[model samples]
Target: MTSITRLFDFPYYQQDKYISIPDALVTKQNGVWVKTSTEEYISKANAVSRALLRMGVKKDDKIAIISTNNRTEWNIMDIGVLQTGSQTIPIYPTISEDDYEYILNHSGAIYCFVSDIEVLRKINLIRNKIPNVLEVYSFNAIEGCKNWVELLKIGEDETNQYLVEEQKNKVQTEDLATIIYTSGTTGKPKGVMLSHRNIVSNVLNSAPRIPFEAGKSRALSFLPICHIFERMILYLYQYYGVSVYFGESIDKISDNIKEVKPTVITAVPRLLEKVYDKIYAKGTELTGIKKKLFFWAIDLGLRYEPYGANGVWYELQLKLARKLIFSKWKEGLGGNLDLMVSGSAALQTRLARVFAAAEIPVMEGYGLTETSPVISVNDMRNKGFKVGTVGKVIDGVSVKIAEDGEILCKGPNIMMGYYKDEKLTSEVIIDDYFHTGDIGEIDAEGFLRITDRKKEMFKTSGGKYIAPQLIENTMKQSRFIEQIMVIGDGQKMPAAFIQPNFDFVKEWAKIHKIEIGTTNEEITADPKVIARIQEEINRLNDKFGNWEKIKRFELTADIWSIEGGHLTPTLKLKRKIVMEKYIDLFHKIYN
Candidate 1:
């Protein structure tokens, strides 16, 4: 067992761990044959810095990077930009042409590093719109773009190390490091400017909350590094010399986890749900005693609690079950895992509690891009670790409850401001406090429970308001629901558009002798499918008020994905886009 004393220090656990210009980034190379140690990372980064100088990149210039996750390439390019005193803008691989145009033009990025065909195509399509962009470097051997190897060859030349050192001398904590653009739920995206201090300070603050054992610690990174949660973790790893292993693709995270044997890695709720679904799928394949034991263990895990006292016999049984049953769960996650940190969206407390009880503690964190990502996190070691609360505020931060019960935070981790958005920035950031749009109540123990997003709470025509996220999370527990959006404002009652988990539904169909005929149209129209979805919807309605419940619903045959423009790059529901796309369904339900 890990020591409680080591895991936390009062006032949001921190370490004196310092990072500097001379610090080497820990990375892995292209072939998986090369592990770039911290020393090698610095050298390669300086070389890439030289290449940027040769490409005419200057201090304070914006350098856009378009890439899938590549450790060496991303770091060198990232640190290379930093070494030259220029800022890097890392765009998500899943982003669209319109967003690509807006970010490129808005940030005035002069150079972009493209790693894949799609990113290059996006840059090519938006070339005219982004007039200031001059150079494009591809990390892969794509035609018509300058190859990454060529840049590395020049980076290895050492001709500009003098120039690199010259540029590095000018870098400081107060300087704007990068501009992460958060797409608006309503209007245009706003660029959040985070300083070097903001990034580094958060890295330092978050260290003690996690389990880290020098060279032994590793992470399988799959989340979009463009998002600040993952991005700040990247910096945390860089500064602390933690080994970060990049997953080949979203498809390979499980297999890669086994290869990396990561001690800990961060995730959002959607990914965790998939992991749970996989375990459930495997359990279905077993039979008789095996199936019974598998199911019994799972049911126990679902209802397990760590905070309360239990009988010695029950505790011992749980311990034995964890070894015989749940240890494989960790082994599947690369065996060496100490924790799984979850954030960005609300993690259902039920999910968080189960994982923790199973020995795979999900340290649910809460924050936004505007706060350099991390604000509050649950330390598994903390005695008062509440199931539903998002833990206490992290070190070097002050959280206050506003008169309206809105959670307001003032911290070094808060962003400099929304770039070029003086009006919005002024409204949100008042008197050095970042006004988080979340309605939350802090308990006597100082743990914060998020009631809802302020903007998401909407009143009905009769004036009773409801928090949609709360309803949405509860509804998602249904096996049939792959996604859901609760719509109400101005209506007498709330209704929902539910996206059924087609894969699970198909499994049920197979068992029930329902003939799907290998086509989506037949399967969706099947009475079994409709009946199954309705059953789950009715089950979820038990917790909600009559008006707040999903009074009516529609299930679409089509799936919502990043490519489909239904979900955002971060796997968050694009509420506006999804509702507008299915206006007819809502209209029919309302009418």
Candidate 2:
């Protein structure tokens, strides 16, 4: 039994704890690792808050932060902003210039903090257009701009420490702490106003459910801090005094995990899928008994059930399999990882089951930015952890399936409203229930299984409704598919645009003695390649209904990406953008 006492109401969690712990919070500066103790973090944050106050920043003022996860500074600035009763507006540094201008203007942010030179350049590009933004500060000490450290130095005062403490006490739980602008798939981003009460409610309610040791557990923070999921989880980690090591970059996470050997981590499904694919690719390289054993271990894992025992003989084999294969699998994720938390998208059930069986448990969860980011999560500590579902509705939250199957949630975690968009907010919130726009069903066991996005479901000319997400998820199970989009709204039949897994296809072609051309265009146009992809599509078609079956498909060499505007930052497909970009491919298939 773990000895972590969970809290139910964390009103002044960060303010109180940062003072009490006085322990190190790790960060990377340049190429060296540095530890800023909690006391140092609090002092720096207070000094910065005083600097902002000196610069005429008042309570309820909107301050914006456009940065990647520069761990120490990000957390300190957030604390500073909130302590002064100013709301922080976090924007993804990768956002387009237009979005940057719009968000800054709409939020009326008077001061902005940027991460690096490029981010500073982006702000300067639109500085004149966004008239309300008074000044830009950099996390990095770039030329001609105020740096965050300077703010701390400018306002540092030993005598005024009591005033900072008073400021912390003055903050009410109901005060607005941040306005998070969600870059959703379908439309312009909306500013989600989350009060201190909203986020603290989530932290307190959701923390006890996650099984982690207080002082023993360590987490590798790599996900974007601008995301509420990561931010909320950070607060939970702080509450438990869990040591956190920030990854240098997204590309460096694997290396960081091996070095840090963290016990916990959070991720989106895309990252997990990539990890699964990498593991599967490694299995293909083995020979004879080793290859057989590798696949056998995976098969056993996929058959694993959390709730029911698989008999003594089966358990014995599982133990052997764990020793021979799964243990090494855990080593790849850093030997200490007990479990992982997956959110922002639905995890593939196959991957979920296989990982669970491999002893590297993945607790899949579900929610949106509006609900403090977590509405339900599978508790891996419990026997009822189901692979296909997002687990049960969390405590302090109520979920209902509407007549049309949209998931409706009523919770204290729900956003106060869309900032400056009352009419838009009213459309989604009715009588205190927030319409989640996701179509899902709750089982008798209380597991919530999300099937499709209500807006993404479409009908064919034959009047058959097809859930594109269902077909897409099934198609992704194929080894050749890297990405796929299902299209047929008002058309005679469904068609698909698929991006093939280049590395897998190259390896396969070499083994089969098929010659693919050097260029992507030539490779995609190859008859053998097209024929092989079609065969995989045909196999998947057997699993779907007549209307949902993909009758034709066009293979593409191009992988969809955030920069390409075909995918959101979370990797959810921008269907509308994809349709526009590939209209010629769809025309070729349909016409």
Candidate 3:
């Protein structure tokens, strides 16, 4: 059996030495779940490699893929590009067209593959700008775009199999596998260059931390595969021979979860927050015994402690909660979900505890695109899990807290460097350690807890420092607050610009018979709505220092979203942009 070293070797490894199942990759097509076998997966990938070879693709050449969702075609194209000793540039489909032009030209990509017509439309808008791209292909056949099936037909002859083999053999584990452009909160995106070893080592090391039966577990993948967190998990799924079902889209995740009945999935904190809010909102609709039991279960969940640390009486009540109210919660998420790995941002500790109490554990991890993304993660096995922390560092990876509380990581999983920016790369990777730019501390038990982004922390005129994330995460636990950003970096006192839970406010208004208007603008401007939100702020503010508490705030009439230029693709607030967008609100709160 060939050892799995290169990124392309995962599928081949699964097919040859590992379990080869009939349903290796599944995708929902035309309202049906379509399965692609291991043999077919490899065959199509080889065909893609041969076709690229025929198209004059050479070693070190770049190919680009932009997809709106995770699908079988994306995986096939990824392996195909890597097999030809070429690097694949995976771009976020939601980014602006200017970014598309910059990345395509910067990477010197000779060919481009897009998932759907929306992506094709974006590419066509910048087609003239990206002159390096000789041709464009689409996974979904569009009117004027070249279809990927053409490549399959072009490489139908088996006579060229030896040439694909020649290229595969020449490819080393240290060779560049892909260039991932991070969706920065500010400025132009930097292309993070990762080698085959960087990702493969991360997969192998991080695999054991997640407990799943190799061939028996089914995974529902909805997160964008373009991100290393999800992409690495995809390769991990392949490595374990687990069958993967790609969700149609984010809007269809709940329905897809029901259809697939997957045992494991990956999620961001925002998605989980939405799920919890929806469930909580439904609970509010219940009355009498059901409503009492619902709140009882939630109260029990919020104080959850693992390893029977909450005592036997609490355990008994938790068992009752799980059997009654939490069981329905599980059913809503397809009933088979045993684990969810949360990354890309700090997950609220209460969300982690409550979900674990419901028997679906959310193991939150922390890392950036430069580290092949997994530095430390919470694992349930062997007491490696921690509620408020990001858990212990994975095996073969070492993490240390710097003098100023920055998390420094050193491991084989670290990226080679930022593509084409040596000065910027050298600034972060010093003394063989990658500076994570996140302020954190490793506990006595070795659990890492992130406090805030180093660059985001600020001091008021009073000379006391404030970590906005800590305040923001705590404030968001309020049912009335949907999103928030704490301000007053160099001002007199800490304040906030908030986007209230507009839907929840409407529901609350109905229950209380308040005369709040229907539109967001009218609702935000309502004095009654403002007073109620102030009550919530006063309640949650008791947990913070007086200096850190939000002294004043103004509500936004619109949702903060990626399309609004208020958030990054990963759902983190573009703080500068948010402040600029709400400058009037800022002045109203401070002045």
Query: Model 2 — TM-score against the truth?
Result: 0.95
- Over 1-591, each residue of candidate 3 has an lDDT whose tens digit, in order, gives 658999999998888855467888999888989999888999999999999999999999999999998999999999998999999999989999999999999899999999999999889888889999999999997998899999999888878989999999999999899999999988898999999999999999999999989878899999998999999999999888889999999999989999999999999999999999999989988999999999999999999989999999999999999999999999998989999999999999899999999999999998899999999999988899989999999889999889999989999999999899999999999999999899999889999999999999999999999999999999999989999999998899999999999989998999899999999999999999999999999999999999999989999998999888898888999999999899998888777
Better of 1 and 2 by TM-score: 2
> What's each prediction's TM-score?
0.93, 0.95, 0.99
Q: How far off is residue 462 in model 3, in Å? A: 1.3
Which number leads on TM-score?
3
Worst 10 residues of 3 by lDDT: 13-22
Query: Candidate 1, TM-score vs. the true structure?
Result: 0.93
Candidate 2: tens digits of C-alpha lDDT, residues 53-73? 777888889999988654778
lDDT of 1 by residue, 1-591 (tens): 211121011101112232222222333446463465555555666677888788788888999887776455786677767778889887887778898999889999988888789788888987888888887889878888887667678777786689887776677777888998885565677899988778777877887776666434667777878888887787666544566777777887887788778878889998888888788789889999888878777877777767555567667778877887788787788788878888988888778866776788888888989888788988877564678888888899889989998989998889999888899899999999999999999998889899898988888777888888999899887667888888888888887777778888888878888776566666667777777788888888899887677777777767878888788777888888888899998888889
lDDT of 2 at 352: 90
Q: Which stretches of model 3 miss by more than 4 angstroms? A: none
Question: Which candidate, 2 or 3, would have the higher lDDT against the true structure?
Answer: 3
The lowest-lDDT stretch of 10 consecutive residues in candidate 1 is: 3-12
lDDT of 2 at 542: 96
